[model samples]
Target: MYGIYIYNSKNRNITIGTKEEKKFSLDIYQIYTHDPLEELLNEFREGQFSTTLTSKQKHMLLKMVRKNRPAFAIDEEPLGKIRGHDIELYLDVEIPYPPMLRRPPYPESLESRKESEKHINELLEMDVIRKIRHKEIV
Candidate 1:
């Protein structure tokens, strides 16, 4: 299991949780990850790879993240509600809501659980997912 913690980047850049050799990447506004999982996620979020770019060139990448606001607004408290957004604006849209049921978590072996725990811890560091105090199905 491996993950990266990018201090400042749009999309929160989360890679798919995988069971593999352990590794991690660290970034400060600028980021470069040498993993296929992250590379693919980057394409969907920020664009392409620039691994060969010089250090000075890498700084240009900082501009790619969303400016003036954090990207994890919906991932914050009372999840899915962005500040200043009026629900009325979406009244006409047929938004897909989650079913009101609690499915048991899939069974996993110890090794798999350990791997997932590491990945979840990494997500905590990046604020891609925050702590929840209670469980409520909606």
Candidate 2:
């Protein structure tokens, strides 16, 4: 006889007639939801998810799996849990952008400009810089 059984706790020993079977098992955790994709999409559409995420996160979910970042918990509340009647979902939500990566400071010092000019000159000498010039009509 073949059978599949789910136990609330870990079970190690099973006795059948004169034979005793011992098996080591680990806990199986899963996220359950009636409509996981739809729910995740709804949450994203409503702007209920975080935006912070690394390139890895984007590559994993968005590029690899073709799923939106907000749809998964990786870009928002990662440890958040959503409970349903039949299923429980675990999320690792993350914010989309890091504060530091946004709104970079503008260069305000002449020294900075000089350093940039030096670099540009070096690139130009190496023929690695292409200058686009517009002619003025007199």
Candidate 3:
């Protein structure tokens, strides 16, 4: 494959490509010098967010993020916990009894089902979701 190179210097902005498809050039050599994934991860960890907002707008956004920091997940972590967050909902519609709704099981291959079960078990272990036995439900 042709190797593409971009040069952005003080006086010039040029893109150069190697002629030979199979020949490995400096452009191709530089490609493997750094991992793009790792660079992106590092940027995320460093909080290097790029935005077109003005300085004042950016400050306001930063303040909001800092204030609601617990609500956002970092590094695949679960959402932030809000202390004393007991919620109650009052519906206008009245029902004689609790409604029971059930859906058919999703169609999945054996391998896919096993994978899903493994992931769900991991989430349960991590306390991301509660496991309720049939008897526990009213």
Candidate 4:
């Protein structure tokens, strides 16, 4: 996807509810695309953006997708997870009893059932899901 952003710089001290702010700058322009482009020229022309792109410029943008393809998510060697040691997740709940152990059900349709089974198998293969010995968490 192609994106464009424009900013207008203004300085002001803090108060509530006015255009001026110390926290953020004014957003003048923003453009982004997530879908396949059928006709590049017509799509770019339709928006209410302050600026416009020529057909040649639009064509050049699409070339980025062909020239630079991303590595798949399955390629975990380069993109290891970003779990910071300083941060932790905490769950706060006031429950009367323990959390329920529920295996509600998978979809009944044949295709859905097959997809569900495939997902389980993939997780098992990846070790994303695994067996572990558990004790009471007093």
Candidate 5:
């Protein structure tokens, strides 16, 4: 993925909720692909953003991407994860607990089940979540 942001600034002292309220307007352009850097450069040459971006701005954007190309490369494999921090779940209720019915797991194909297990394993390996072993009451 490649991204470029351009900020438009009118003046230094900007007031709130005034005409200059929208002083800092930002233009963000992004391209998501696994193509090589050379191909991406060709895309820019072919005027991918000719209408919105000036030649100089486009050149600078492409130059920045080329300079930091290694950081953009990502693995093709998909993994389930929440990147930043641990997530907390809280249930806020004032009513008393009520009886609930249990249902069996949804039916799925062999391939689908394998895919689910693979994602679960990945999450477990990352310590993002833990597996719970439940005993059914008959």
Candidate 6:
């Protein structure tokens, strides 16, 4: 149900669904082999993928020999010469984390301290306060 679709540039064709059950679809979009390759490489360089390559993805094309990889290249032969459906290439790329989910700056500012104190005071007045501990770092 959840899978990527890859277009076969050699014959101006496209395949949808999983690798095993790849069904031929219309080739409305032009296939750009180099663009996807470059984007994947850029993502790898940015450390967006998992630390362990094998765990993240079952297959991957090495950077040095990317051209040799069938998924990254398109055959120059005529459409009639090619047989069977083209291979589907899945990039080892991950969706980036939301900006708000990242760590915030340390050392609260004066305005931040005031706002926090006001909120805490309101909570205390509402009798919703739990155990509180204050410590001063040396």
Q: What C-alpha lDDT values do all the predictions have? A: 0.51, 0.50, 0.59, 0.48, 0.58, 0.53
- Model 2 stretches with alpha carbons more than 4 Å out: 1-105, 134-138
Residue-level lDDT tens digits of model 1 in 18-53: 423433444447676576444434544644557897
Cα deviation of 49, candidate 5, in Å: 2.7
| Candidate 3 vs 5: which has more lDDT | 3
- Model 5, residue 74: displacement in angstroms? 4.9
| Global local distance difference test of model 4 | 0.48
Worst 10 residues of 5 by lDDT: 73-82
lDDT of 4 by residue, 1-138 (tens): 333333444542233344343233444356765545445435444433225876565577645533442321324433323223334445464545344634454448988889988877767665445545677342
On residues 41-76, what C-alpha lDDT tens digit does candidate 2 reach at each position?
A: 554464443478654553344343333343345433
Cα-based RMSD of candidate 1? 21.2
Global CA lDDT computed for model 3:
0.59
> 1 in model 1: Cα distance from truth in Å?
55
In the range 65-113, model 5's lDDT, one tens digit per residue, is 6665444433432343434656677656434643332355679999999
Query: How accurate locally is residue 96 in candidate 1, as Cα lDDT from 0 to 100?
Result: 67
Candidate 3 lDDT, tens digit per residue, 1-138?
A: 445554554433333456433333232323456754455445446676566766566556666766777666665656554546646666665555345323556699999999999989877765556788879942
lDDT at position 81, candidate 3: 48
Candidate 5: residue 114 Cα off by (Å): 1.2
How many pairs of residues in model 6 come into backbone collision? 0
By lDDT, who's the top model here?
A: 3
By summed lDDT, the worst window of 10 consecutive residues in model 4 runs over 71-80
TM-scores, all models, native as reference: 0.30, 0.21, 0.40, 0.26, 0.32, 0.20
lDDT of 1 at 57: 50
- Count of backbone collisions in candidate 2: 16
Off by over 4 Å in 1: 1-101, 136-138
